[model samples]
Target: MLRFCPLSRIDGQKTFVIMERKGDKGNGKQTQKRIAPPQYDEAFKAGAIRMVTEQGRPSTEVAKELGICIDTLRSWLKAAGVQAGQADRQNRDSRRTRELEAEVRALRKQQAEKDEVIDVLKKSVGILSRP
Candidate 1:
């Protein structure tokens, strides 16, 4: 005998529901906490739309990546004042260029560290091999 329940109102506002098993005794144990309902946000929706359209990611995948549901992604796409398949390509291109530049910088830094290590090893080898 499972029962669906609603939140209790306290001070004119709803509070979280705590459910107890039907066959359980009134021993103040075996309680399950209710998860809060989802709330809508405009910015989240816009960002989801942007990720889907601009980043060329699917809505379902983007929703999962963003920790939101597919329905939530749809709602956001509706709210973002943009279509699902329309993204600013120039913006994405520029962003990709920046990302590539940053990656190159990181690789250059790593190469410099490796070069320093090689120089030290070379100096050590020369000293050890000298007459």
Candidate 2:
């Protein structure tokens, strides 16, 4: 006879299940109990994804709060078509582009001022030569 016990919790202790096999004590055969991975429902998974995607929380933080591994959370995000660290990279690129544009504008302004000065000097020389 095989007996399976449901998960139970007692006094703040962890939850676990018990399984027993009868009529196998005298046979000297050992049975190993296999522990399965924990399964999360769809709602739980969606919530975790929302925390990282909508709320803008880091994956590490979400994973830690949900008692799961960081990699696992990342994979879920990946499946949902969200790339980790993409936002940070885009922000950096945009900032650099803005800086470059500002520098170019400043250089053009300085060139224009230099050209104006040269034009004034040329006109003064022409007037002196004409006299």
Candidate 3:
């Protein structure tokens, strides 16, 4: 699970910035990390997509045989306007994950608001007798 932190407020204005928690160095500086791009050329990508589109091979099997990630293979196929059974399923799963994450964030914010209300009520009811 990726943990996201809210950005610090500057000048009393809230700004939104989303960053991945993965590969964090934990020393106050956050830097993005990237892997070396694969050496697959245009012809190679076309050939890989052909293996699935024309050969009717399953994307999973084709990716495994080609030593590439299923998502990468599917992306290449999609960009080439090739539709595979896995593409739809992958899109739905990606959308669902995003929806769930958004829901979690909304729920957390609501819970925080309720906590603030409860604290205010407790203070008004003399739960803490301040000097």
Candidate 4:
């Protein structure tokens, strides 16, 4: 016989299912209690996947932080169509893009400063040549 115990809440959100089973242990009868995997809501699964996919956090790190197995996190990511190395690749690309943009901004600022000095010199020349 199998029976399901009342759902227990952990962290005020996660729900765990406990199962009770009755079996004959050769002598007469014995009861065994087993724990089923916790059931996560859609929001929890999406947040976990977002940590790996958009936040660029490692699945192992995210799993450790969330107190879950790494394999579980990876499975969630896989179901979301995210590859293991895709986050790292995206992070690297974004970092490089930011660096390049900063460099371009710096170069433009330098050019503007040079142009201002040239403008000042041209004004001084016009005044000196005027009378």
Candidate 5:
């Protein structure tokens, strides 16, 4: 008479998994399997902050939507140089501002020159009329 010990069987599968008996005391040990965790990216955190700020979504809502903690979103915002209720300083000024300022100064100088010419013309007319 022979005794067979079965370990596991998959459903509808014609395969049998068996574990061998070991040791003088009849103790058997199974091998352990290892699983690796997923990798995280800081870019995802930055994207979450952009979504919340640019989309005008609430912090808690954005965190829930992204399946992350609210604190993580806050930290991401800090890293991206954005503050709550404050404009992003990095994007506040640009070459366009400098161009606009230069344009305004040039227009003011042109107007000042025109004003001086008009004053001279008026003085000549007044002098001619007095004679």
Candidate 6:
């Protein structure tokens, strides 16, 4: 249901131009709930694929063990060629892995720069403490 507010109340004119929110019930409607995303890592995905292909286990069983959705796991298998389906999860995984690796490399470089600054500060302090 959409409730509207009057656009112009002058000259006995009553027209609703603004629409209310969908969840507006009584005084004020509660905010919509947030849907959390499915979280998984590359290593975990490789393991799940291994379980289905190498061990000859069902995709549903593997998904149960990994605490992931069966359909999601099956999609992974289909991309990995374990089962017959149409989807290209491998390319997506490759891109994601590259992105993660780049982030890790950048973080490492930042840490090295900080370490150098700390070493320079320590040397200056030692030089000032002369006898």
Greater-TM-score candidate between 2 and 3: 2
Encode model 5's per-residue lDDT on 7-108: one tens digit a residue: 333443233334344542245445333223223486776677777666655667777887767667776777788774342332334435777899999999
Query: Per-prediction RMSD in angstroms?
Result: 11.3, 7.7, 26.7, 6.4, 15.0, 19.8
Prediction 1 TM-score vs. true: 0.39
- What's the number of clashes in each of the models? 0, 0, 0, 0, 0, 0
The alpha-carbon deviation from the true structure for residue 70 of candidate 2, after best TM-score superposition, in angstroms, is 1.5
Q: How far in Å is the alpha carbon of 125 misplaced in model 3?
A: 99
The lDDT values for all models are 0.69, 0.72, 0.72, 0.75, 0.62, 0.67
- Which of 1 and 6 is ahead in lDDT? 1
TM per prediction: 0.39, 0.43, 0.39, 0.53, 0.34, 0.41
lDDT of model 5 at position 81 = 81
Candidate 6 wrongly placed segments (more than 4 Å):
1-27, 84-131
Best by lDDT: 4
Runs of candidate 5 with Cα error greater than 4 angstroms are 1-39, 85-131
Give the per-residue lDDT of model 4 (tens digit) for 21-110.
545235454444445677789999999888877776667778999998887877787788887667657866877888999999999999
Q: Could you give candidate 2's per-residue lDDT for residues 7-106 as a string of tens digits?
A: 5345433343444466556666544443445667788888988887676666777889999887777777788887757633554566688899999999
lDDT of 3 by residue, 89-114 (tens): 55556668889999999999999999
In model 4, the Cα lDDT at residue 82 comes to 84
- Poorest 10 consecutive residues by lDDT, candidate 6: 84-93
lDDT value for model 5: 0.62
Query: Model 6's lDDT to the true fold?
Result: 0.67
Q: By TM-score, is 1 or 6 better?
A: 6
Task: Give a tens-digit lDDT track for model 1, residues 5-75.
Answer: 66765444444555656675557565455656565466766677777776766676787887877776776
